[model samples]
Target: MYMLRKFRKVFSLIILTTMMSLGITAPGYAAMLGTDDILAGDNLQQQRDYVKELLNRDEVQNQLADMGVDPLEAEQRVDAMTEQEIQTLSSQLEELPAGASALGLLAFVLVVLLITDLLNLTNVYNI
Candidate 1:
């Protein structure tokens, strides 16, 4: 009877520890960014920069001051944009550019190589 009581005590302690751990971690988990953070962050830098660039143009500086974006923060965010992101800004302003179809291009090239091999078109084709 004593052994059984001891076993039950240990099991209860384990379950209690797990529950405590979860409760302690719950607030940290809640602070995490979700899907909305991801989508919003995607354009965060661009929006910041657009505000600055437009601010630098005629009369927009006063507009930005009215909007409460600190001039330094706006400048910093603009400078922080990566080169690829800057390129995206230009591309986004225009219609999407034409591009090769990845799967189609891969298939087309593979077929052409196979046909060339079957025809023994190159000295490198052994059989």
Candidate 2:
């Protein structure tokens, strides 16, 4: 009978300690279960936010710098781009001709020169 009383005391202490350690707040804890489910809303902002997130990636920014694209200007362009444009940007990044990333800036400059050459807007190397 003495052991039974001690066992009850221990069990009561364990329940008390468990409740205290769980930090049960006095208000509205049970009310949360009664709340209605949330409904979905318009998603345009989500699309814009997702595009903005893509522009923040390391590889896209790195590739921009490699291709002589100014960091700020590229950022501006990205910001100005439509969601459709941003959608295409990731694939376009991969299609950049392979080369040294930093030197890619110089390569971009070279590409511009070639464009002018083809257009006959500039002389070849001798000029």
Question: For every model shown, what is its TM-score relative to the native structure?
Answer: 0.28, 0.31
Write down the worst ten-residue block by lDDT for model 1: 100-109
Stretches > 4 Å off in candidate 2: 1-42, 83-127
Alpha carbon lDDT of residue 9, candidate 1? Answer: 100
Candidate 2 lDDT (Cα, 0 to 1): 0.53
User: Residue 1 in candidate 1 has what lDDT?
Assistant: 100
| Each model's lDDT | 0.50, 0.53
For all candidates, the clash counts are 0, 2
Name the runs in model 1 displaced over 4 angstroms.
1-54, 92-127
Q: Per-residue error at 106 for model 1, in Å? A: 42
Q: Give the top-scoring candidate (lDDT).
A: 2
